[model samples]
Target: MKRLHAPAICSWGHFYIGVRNLMKNPGTGKYAASLTCTLLLAGMACVALGTFFYFYRVKPAATAGVLNNIDWGWELSYHLPYVLISMGAFSCLFSLVLRKIDFSGYERPDVWLLSLIFITLLFYSISSQIRFLDNDEYEHLHNAWMMKEHTIPFFSLHFKHSPLLEWITVFFMSLQNPSTLIIRTMRLFIFLLSCGSLCVIYLIARNVFNSYRTALVSVWIVLCNFVWMEKSPEIRPDNLMVFFCLLAFLALIRFHETQRSRYIFLFVLGSLLSFLGKQNAAIFIFSIGLVVFRHVLGSLRTRRFGIILITTGITITALAVLMIPHDIILDIGFKHLIPNDNKFWPTRFLYKILEKNPEIFLLFVAQIFLFKKIKTSHPIFKEYILSVSIVALAFLFLMNRPWMQEMIVMTVFMTLLAADALSRLFRKTGVIICTLILLAMAIPANRRLIKKYIVKKTMTRDLITTETILKISGKNDLVFDSYGKPIFRHHPLEPRYLMYFPEKFSRLELLEKSRTKFLIKDSYYPRLPQKTIHWFENNFRKTKKDPNIYVRDMAGRK
Candidate 1:
């Protein structure tokens, strides 16, 4: 046992205390390093929690099959509160992480704003499902099924054009069953793609504006809209194409910065993918051409111009040859929409775009000022501004018509621009004050969308009918929906190709051999053929109606 003097013991104890003190009060360098670590941990925690909640609660509940015996109307009623709570929690966590982030020399406000926009977009795209409660979405699904089952889209929304959308549908159907709910869930993939594209947008805006606020403003413009958020989950190829177009735009901007062949290749590939995704994607090509003409022409002297022109011409030739194969062109008539359908399909070019999306035109007028501000920092934004402006103006001027179908795209752009405008206003002023203003506008908009679509129309009634039909008819058997109602025709039955063509098939044979049921379209029996009506009257017995769908047993046995 080594014995120490009291003085030696006391000196050793002091040394230990000093070491503890140094560890506790480690200087500014240590403080910053600690702060960074804390922020990282907090961000990770929030993300983990969000993922847990999303998988366990949001995704499952939102994508829950209609067959579940829950009151979907009531369940849907909880969506807003649920989303708000999750978003609020995420915001708080993210904000805390922001606090620890050392803005330091990289005080690029664009970085911060872009981050916020990116997160906002991710939130909506991830959380929301498609708002395609209407018949059009079903039509898209029908096209997808046809693609999967080896059928083709005959007409509508590029209808009667090559079965292009079939390829998109098949892509989705391959991932999951051909259930409407599953199709809706696939929107998450689009949402994720949109987020990835926003990264490019952020980079472009950051370089152009050199201001985080400007970059963020562009992002804000993309988010905070019912149009994009509500429709994120739709099975439409438009959303997918939009994200791809954004990616192409980003690549173009990168090419401007780096002047690299690789980026140009990316730009071309992305643009081509966008073009192939939907008809509107062709517009993106025109916009890209306009941007190229603006930039490349400015720097070209006689010699440079010749070289650039030659290179451009060769590129164009190659792309054209690649895209427009001779056989494919012959198979797909190069002529504009089926001849002599002017009543349903107008040939007036401007009228076609305008008529399909008049609101887009109005939104352009409204967003003009914001575009002006954005152009101050980014000259390229002017090209997009001009492109969209020219398209809208030309459509209005030429056809003097409205493009009602284009509302979805127009609304998406408008809402994005509006959100940006609003975000800028808030940043310039304060969030507390701006939020009140947004609320004032939001209330009316919410009421209009909810009352007009979600409430008064009562579209989910169709879901109930489908469920009832499946229950009565059994999942294994083929059933005829006699409920000749347009909703039935427009929705569940229409897409499934389950509608009975009166003259083509033997109804008696179908009913007697397989356990099939006739779902009377009690609402629209007037439109049903007399032969179909007589057959239903003779063979089936009406089982029930109200609080449930009416089912009739074939052969008059019931």
Candidate 2:
């Protein structure tokens, strides 16, 4: 690893030379512009590091000793304005830097651009330290906690989501020290996957578009998106799935360039890994065939077309039979959510993207009227088009419900289109115009990023209730969370997912049969049935003076 990274290391001397070169080649005001840009980037880097330290100052232990008591609302309201003003200042400054910097002397994968990505991601992910787990995360983490005994994930994060993520969680959990907080290590895992995803996004962009600036812009566009920023650090299965899908996409793009059998093997490996991560990742398998379809069409009567179609068909079948035969529910859903929203139809989909994800949407629209000329026969052009087509069509045709984080799978294609547009725009108007356009795009994205990923505080109620549960309950205390969550090491009143299907077994019966030490609703757990609420009213009283908590009454229970 050291040998591989040796050539790309960014030394201070390199920057000094870069600066000295700027000073020497100045027409008039270039030196001052370069110095100011340097100062602003440095200042932003310090703020990012300082913010991370400020939140994580109190180190996490076995208990949640790291959490703070600051009102999340107060924190956001107090600092958000200052954050935005500062972001705008640096964004404009960096745009000037891009406009004036002599990047001609720098080589591919510019060290400065790479450093910017690393710093921004490092800052962006620190929010995971304070961010509360959503209700789905509670379920997902519970399954992960149960990984020691149950590796199958019979009723998983979404009841039917794949088990690879839970398996990986088990490996992380196994490696954690008993003295340290397991969740903190899990946070590190999520952070690593988030970083890996962005780095691959850069690689795919560079390969497809063949321009460092385009790749850099695409990475920023993806990093700044609201959904990606918000869900990037989550414990959900899709988080891992997104990383694998990008690998498959990049591998297939590589294969298209050099019909190597190794790339095909890589494509298969990535597709299988992603499929095991989440079923939705089958979109990538479909995309692979479409992206390589042109190559197959020429030999439609020959073995080539047969090979591609047969490979795709076999892959889909293998993934389906991997678990679907054993769990038929994997291929079916309970129709939990009906699409009554504005996006129920295909026609309104782009319009919704326009409203909710305006930055990528606009850039993609601009890509249609590219600012520079390109040959239609180019391999990159064809790969880009087919990929965009297959991915967009898959979303429209297959999604039972498509919005928010579901679009994470489509980010690569959207960013690719955006990068192509920026490349064309830069060709016509130079780095100044492209830089201005990028900052303009990231403004709204950063607005969402600040509100959702940075300043915004969430999961306060869960944090309070969880801490209280840990304090009041014994190691063997039986827990009954309607949401099927695990409270650290507490005993569960019944099989966790039994609550997921209330009709199969009466929760009241389970409660009566077990010790039923405590119940934690925590605001967002599913509401109890009327009879169960009545049963709880009779047998339990609030523990820790928290209304959301219910502990057994000794007088009644004994």
Candidate 3:
């Protein structure tokens, strides 16, 4: 008989009322709010001072005009301090605002945040697609062209790294009309792989943390990282390798969750694919194998443990046998694992790490405050830390090349840990703060990237200049230059010879005696001997309008 009225939904009204009540209270709630504000302000001040010291005192002194010759008294004194202060202030304010909002009740906000991240990263990647390729990218593209033209057999580059990336480039180049579009098309494909890697990172974080919010926050942190942003969209094997490496980690996580033999097989498959993408992926593959081995040992009492071991053994052995001929099995040993004088010093590598990703460095400092929480949280957390440390140490002691790119896998691990630390320590507020801090730190690097790659347009200039020179030169004529080797290799107007400026100038007479016609010299080179410069100036007429190029026709003159 009684008509029951369901309560009308008034979420916003309730929130308003709660805020008013807290404002009115003079007891613990108000005090707690005031204390939080004080702590936030204090933290911001400390960040401002630390950043100031780092840039003004530490950085300039360390580099000492080697790479940074900017007037620090004016630039660092004004612009940098202003930026750092603004960033610190903005982060604190943003965190305060985020602390009031309850994101847990709605799924839409999380989806919106994740979509924003994806879009931002996609835009950056698209911008980078048209930008110039890196030196390593150029080398890979040249090698791919060599294979496509039958100048070199397939899998020639596979001995050093892997041929899969080059083969893919060749396939895409085959679709396009002009060979120059090969780099652009390959960049687009690499962009997709980068997106895949981002997705895998999200999935792994979600699985490990069991929270979509945390995972989304993790992805945001990673997207804000300059190294990830810079390296992801480039035409290089590292992007493909990183994607498969993340996929392998995802499979490992799934195996841990479900105790499934299929997931183990998937892990093995992913690891092999990653190795095929780049030999450096062996570091990640071995780390995952260790995790799997640990899992197997832990589950020794279970009935399926033996089956797991047998399947894993079979899969690994099969992969090893298949990779032996390709040289992937011994690649790491031959390249990085052997100790050499060129090995990067651990201290210097650590400094470079801080120099490259200051945001990660900041978050690492934040992680120190949350060390107790992280230590008590999960076994997998310790495993990640240990694995990253091991890989980083290995890189420091053994790797001859620049270890920055190789540390990307370690960056992922650090990002996950940083995300987890933020979540545990400060919840939603920390997420907002950390994200803003990272973006702020990335400002200088992002500006430099845009200036160098997008605004300057040297790559396009070089490409057009090379194409023009190729059109004028005869088929049998040798084109000599230090730069644009990739362009020459791909287009092949004539057989191009790369000559080092100072190092090979002693043999300039030999090049002059040969059938070399056009000398495409970049203006960036040091001044040659006045006699040789006068000879080049007098003998060969400039062929192109590009001021950076010095094209001289050898046959028309002396």
Best by TM-score: 2
lDDT of 3 by residue, 292-326 (tens): 57776777997687778878888999988886774
Clashing pairs in 3: none
TM per candidate: 0.58, 0.71, 0.65
User: Tens digits of per-residue lDDT for model 2 on 151-181?
Assistant: 3344544445677876776777677632124
Worst 10 residues of 3 by lDDT: 1-10
Tell me the deviation in Å of residue 219 in model 3: 2.0
Q: Which stretches of candidate 2 lie over 4 Å from their true place?
A: 1-119, 151-159, 177-180, 301-353, 365-381, 388-393, 401-403, 484-487, 490-506, 545-547, 555-558
lDDT of 1 by residue, 134-221 (tens): 4445555555655555444434342433344556556767786434343334444454555554455545555555545545554554
For all predictions, the C-alpha RMSD in Å is: 12.1, 8.5, 14.2
Best by lDDT: 2
- Backbone Cα, N, C clashes tallied per candidate: 26, 0, 0
- lDDT score at residue 88, model 2, on the 0-100 scale: 32
Q: How much is 360 displaced in model 1, in angstroms?
A: 8.3
- Model with the higher lDDT, candidate 2 or 3: 2
